[model samples]
Target chain A: MSLHAGQHPSTTAAPDATTGTRDWLIASAAAIVALIALYAVFFDNGSLIAATGSYLHEFAHDGRHLFGAPCH
Target chain B: MSIPVLPLLGRGLTAGGAAGLTAGLFSLLLAEPLMDRAIRLEEARSHEHADSGAAAVQHHEELFSRSTQHFGLVVTSLVFGLALGVLFAIGYALVHRRDPEAAPWPRALLFSGAAFLAVSLLPALRYPANPPGVGDGATVAERQGLWLAAVVIGVLGMVLVWQVYVRLAGRSAPVRQLAAAGTAVAVLAVLFALPGNPDEVPVAATLLWDFRVLSIASHALLWAVFGVVFGALGLRALGRTAAPAPSGAVPAG
Candidate 1:
C-alpha cells in the first residue's frame, strides 16, 4: 500500500460546497465576535457601552492598561 | 487529517478560559499593586495642579470603587481571553486547511506565539504601556488610533510573511527560512515608519519602566499559558480523531 494512501481515512473524502460554506460562516462569525470583544476591552472609551454608563470602560480599565491598550 | 471546525473552536474556548484565568490571577497579585500606586500618583498630580490654579480638576466620584474595579479586571481578562481563543480557533482552522499534515501541537503553539508577537509585543514596542498618570488626557484618542494602527500593521505583516514562507516550500529549507526572514525584516522596516505616541512620559523613569515591565510580563504569561493549553488540548483532540497509521507510514518522532 502507498504511504499516503488511507493516511487520513476519516477526512479522505473531498470537502463539498456545503462544508466550505459552513466553514466560511463559522470563521466569519468568530471574527465578528472577536472584533466586538477587542473593541470592548481595548478601544472602548465610554462609547460602546455608554448606556451602562462608564461601567464597561471602568471594568476593563486595568485590563486595558495591562494588555497595553491605549488608556488614560 | 481535516478536523471539524466546531470541535477545534470548543477546545480554543476552553483553553482560552484557562489561560485567561491564569493571567487574571497573575495580574491580581502582581500588577494590581503597581496600578494602585499609579492611580494615587495621578490623583496627587491632579490635586497639585488644582492647588496651583493651573487647571480646573473635576473630582468626579468613581461610579465603582477601586475594589470593584479590581474584581472587574479578572472578568475583563477572562472575556478578552475568550475572544482571543475564538480568533485562535479560526486562525488554526484556516491554516490547517492549507497544511493538514503539520502536527497540531507545534502549530497551535507557533500560532499563539505569532499572535503574541503581532498583537502584544510589536504594539507595545511601538507604543509602550503607560500608567494612569503618564499620558495626556487630551491626546488619548490620538494615541489609541496610533496603537491600533500599529497592531493592524503588525498583523498584516505577519500574514504577509506567512504567505511568503508558504510559497517558498518547494525551495530548500534554508532558502525558505531566509526568504521568510527577509520578508519579516522588510515588514519590520515598514512598522518602524509608523508615527510615535503623541504623549510624553512625564512620570519618573523608574515607575514608568517598572509598570511597563510588569504589564508586559502579565501579557507574556497570558500568551504563554494560552499556547501551552491550546496545544495540549488540540493534540488530545487530534489524537482522538486520528486514524491508525499504516505500517512504515508513521513518521518517527
Candidate 2:
C-alpha cells in the first residue's frame, strides 16, 4: 500500500484494540513466528531436503491425487 | 556414470525452488493482504480533516503499492531462498571443504543478509514503495508484521526459540531462560534426527505450549523491523522535512 517514506508496516503495526492482554500476547506471538519464518525461508535446513522428498513423491506419484485435493 | 551428481543437483534445485515458491505464495495469501489493509487504513486516515475523496484515492494508491509489493516479496523469496542455500554450499565447499552447518549463527545470518538485499531494496520491489505504508497506529502493525516475517522465514528456530524469548521476557529469570533455551535446542535436535517434513510438527501442537508461534505468519514483520532500524540509521543519511510528501509528487527531501 502507498505509505510515507518513514512509515512502513513494521513501523506502523497496531494492536487489535480490544481490551485485554490479547494484544500483548498476539504481538508477542507474531514476533516469535516471524523470526522462525525468516529462518526457514533463508536458512539451509534438512527440511528442504524433506520437502524435496514430499515434492517429488507428490509430483511423481501423487500429483494427480494431491492436485485435486488442494482445490477441493 | 557420467552425470551421477546431476540428478542429485537437479533434485536439490527443484526442491529449493518449490520451497521458495510455496513460501512466497503463502506470504501473498496470508501476509501481503494484511499489510495491504494496514496501508489503506493508514493512508485513508492520514489527513487532519480530509474528505472521503482523499481517503479513496489514498486507498487506491495503497492497493497499487500492495499488489506490487506482494509479488515482489514472492519473487524475492524465491531468489533469496534458493541463493541463500547455494551461496553457503559453495562457500563451505571452498573454505572448510564441506557444508557449514557447524556455524549456526553464520548460517542464519548469511542468508538473512541475502533477504536484506533483495527484499529490502526499493527498486527490486515491484511496489511503488520498497517498504509498505505506515498509517495511524501503523507502527504497531509494522512491528508485529516485520517480526512475524522473521519468524516465518526462520521457521523452526522461531517456534523453538520464541518460547524462550517470551518466557524470558515475562519471567526475567536467567536460569529458567537458559533451561528453556536448552530444551528448545534439544527438541530441535530430535526433530532434525527424525528427518523430513518442515511443517510436519503442527505449530498448533507446539502452541499447546504457546499460542503465538508461527514462523512465517506475517510478511511485514521482518520488513517493519528493518524499517525501524533503517529509518533511525537513515535519518542522518537524509535531511528532515516536517511535512509528508504532497500528493501527485515525490518527496523532494
Highest lDDT: give the candidate number.
1
lDDT per residue, candidate 1, B107-165, as tens digits?
Answer: 77788889999888888888888876666657879988888888888899888888888
Off by over 4 Å in 2: A1-72, B1-13, B48-65, B91-131, B135-215, B218-253
DockQ of 1: 0.51
Worst 10 residues of 2 chain B by lDDT: B122-131
Best by TM-score: 1
**Residue-level lDDT for A8 in candidate 1:** 51
Q: Model 2 Cα displacement at B94 (Å)? A: 5.8
Please provide TM-scores, in order, for all candidate models, with all chains considered together. Answer: 0.88, 0.30
